[model samples]
Target: MGWFYSIDIIEGWLPATIWALVAIAMVVLLVAQRKSLKRAGLQIGIGLLSGALGLLATWLVSNVFVVFGVSLGWPVIFAVAAGFALLGFAISAAVMTHTWRRVVAIVLIPLALLATTMRVNAIYGEYQTVGSLFDYSPYPHISTLNLSLNTISVKDWNEQVKVKSRNTSNIPKSGKLVHVDIPNTASGFQAREALVWLPPAAFAKHPPRLPVMVMLAGQPGSPTRFFTASDTVKILAEFANKHHGLAPIVVSPDQNTEATRNSLCANTTKWGNAETYLTQDVPDWITENLPVSTQADEWTIGGFSQGGTCSTQLAPNHPNIYGNVLAVDGEIAPTDGSVDHMVKEYFNGSKSAYERQVPRNAIVNNAPSHQLMILGAGERDAESVSNIKKIGDTAEKNGWTVFRFTVKNWGHDWHAVNAVFKVALPYLCERMGLGNANVDFPTDSKIRELA
Candidate 1:
């Protein structure tokens, strides 16, 4: 069952084979219905009309009804419309006079839908494997921090401690994923179990100090998506393999307690004290519990989508906490509802208070500091790209070093997250004094796969 669940549904031969079959079925059905030209015309007409309706429905949901709140964007809108088109074509073709043709078209209906689903999934890149699609937990969830961790002193991390060349003969090949609870002592935010990824260097006989990354999953996601959806562990491990297992020890702390909940990553009465949890509680726990750098420059705050928006908001607001920011497909501002509604609900009806929490405002208000803000978004996700660019402009004007890029042919999905994070890993490692920065986006064959 595990192996079955592990089957790749995005790119590999499985999806390819499934798609090939779907195409063949469509072709066969169209050819069989050639004699019934009138019926064929009607099927095509229905498919076209359905596609138009799909676009209208999508527009209504995204704009008027506000089902998803934000625009699903053109790519997602088109994908949904294509699905409707396929379904319409299949159903119309099925209502033929011939019994065999009807049966074939009936079978093709489910196949067509499944293929459409795959197409949409490809666009989002959310569910790479069946296990991740359904979210199968592989590790035990512990609600307590490890007591016997080799702790780091705060004052010792004043200067950058480079990861000097050392024998990695005893180092493990990859990182270990640990699911543990970070006690929300200060913030009182009821967060879910956080995830920790320790590189092979962490398990070494005498582990050198490593940088820490406080990664946050999307609003509608959990820490587990770092592994299941993003394949982040593998990407980090690949980088670690080249640098004697010296990648940052990434900890994905929970921002939103539940999948559907949106904390807005703020210290508010409406949601939870997410800002306090991230900036204080989570950092304090890391300093005391993990063998990580206590230097703020060595720490990174990053996330995807809502989490991305959080990173943009938090990193500059608490610059002493995080010097590096990696935000992928983030919103222009965090919003639980309409601007006025969010102001009322999350900011006690103070529009000025809500304005302060906006990511661009945070960057603008922040004093000139030695910070690195990596603003990223998928090319297809135009809204996010525009949003990040706005934030990037603010960050640059505020005297922060900014590296901004967009992954072509990707959208506001895990695929974009994986690409942005993986490509930036080498540079981030170098910045944290890991030595030898290898820009692996277009040059490295492995990293190129992300683009």
Candidate 2:
């Protein structure tokens, strides 16, 4: 079973255990009183019912007062205080007739209140530190859920910053041009844009078209944002300068939209045709403007996060275009969809629909060509690590060539993504038919190497 399912089991049993303990305690209390079995059973049932009612009242009061921020005013507080005072007086009168009963009530009441207070405080603290829980917690179950939710929020903020920044700074100047826009196909919704890097060496004796690497951004992100935010431009420059002026042209396209949070880089009704936009439209545009190799083996595609998922999906689907696919911390499968939901969404209301789009299904049914596939996840990223391992296992079983790497203590973030890129770049370059010559480094390197 999936780890999430295991968590569900724990959630179910915890409440059951608590209730069982309450029931057992009631039974012991009645038996210690030397009550008849029938009388003891009746008392236990009434106690359980009373306890349940008290809990329900507490829940309602807490929800109405604390959660909704509603005020009961001084009048209600005074009334409650007076009522509790009367109840205490009545209990004290009854206890005066029995010393042992008084002792039991005195001992248990304070302890119960203390336990309740501690439980409340613990829950409140957990909610307060929700954002930092992933960083603090060592428990895989809690950390995974926390990180996954945090990642989505972080990505949302990052995308907003990216869209704004890219529009402001990366727009090409009319007079001196370093960047070119690849126009969209007949469908205006889907277009590819390529950014070419001419590191002075490209205009050599026999100016030859350079190799190309396509870098994809995360969900709700554009390629321009990757260049602006991440050190894509710097990395390319370093790689090019180190490889004796052999820097591949980098093409980053706008591949995310609202309909599909991830886009998966697949052709789906929810998201506009991203595959056509990237594979067909973008390549055609690149071949026209950039002096880059058009050979299938010369093209390398890589992405981070949702972009990583896209790279995995697109490379195998259209192997003729992408020679190498590097996916960094990608979701192996869509997790939110239930089996029934999957059947409805993909298969005309049938489970058979999962046969084609599911990554494992595809690998098992038809293993694609010997395209270089590199999958990496952070050791601290429980969800991503598990998903990566699942993909690796599927690939291994299917006899598909795969390279899997797990970075230590890294969660699902840019650091892990960059780590994957650093390791995968050389391998990807080699697969893209780039010569194995050592990259030449200038005595004084201008670009900052990612740590």
Per-model root-mean-square deviation over C-alphas: 4.7, 18.6
Q: Model 2 lDDT vs. the true structure?
A: 0.52
The regions of model 2 sitting more than 4 angstroms off are 1-180, 186-188, 191-206, 258-260, 334-355, 397-399, 437-451
- Across residues 1-451, which tens digit of lDDT does each residue of candidate 1 receive? 8898889998898888877887887788888878878988898899899999998998788667857655666777888898788888888888754678788778878887888788878777777788876766666554342333553332222121243323345556777787888999999999988888888766654466789998888868887776677868888889887776678999998898888899899977787798899999999988887778878899999988998999999998999989999888899998887899888888788887788779889888886867988878887777887887788888878888887778887777887888788778888887887757445433321112236
lDDT score, candidate 1, position 3: 91
Over 1-451, each residue of candidate 2 has an lDDT whose tens digit, in order, gives 2342223211255334543543443334444556455644454454445455554555457445433222222323333333333234323323432455445445444433433333332322211122222212212221121111111122232343357543223322211114455666733545434444443333333334556677776654555444443445566566655554455666766676431355446454555666677888778876765556677777877777677767766776666787776776677753325657645653456555444556666566557466666777765555666666787677656655677776664545555666666656665655554446453322221212223
lDDT of 1: 0.79
Q: Record all residue pairs in model 2 with backbone atoms less than 3 Å apart, i.e. clashing.
A: 209-291, 242-439, 242-440, 243-439
RMSD of 2: 18.6
* Cα distance off (Å), candidate 2, residue 400: 3.7
By summed lDDT, the worst window of 10 consecutive residues in model 2 runs over 142-151
The TM-score measured for candidate 2 stands at 0.53
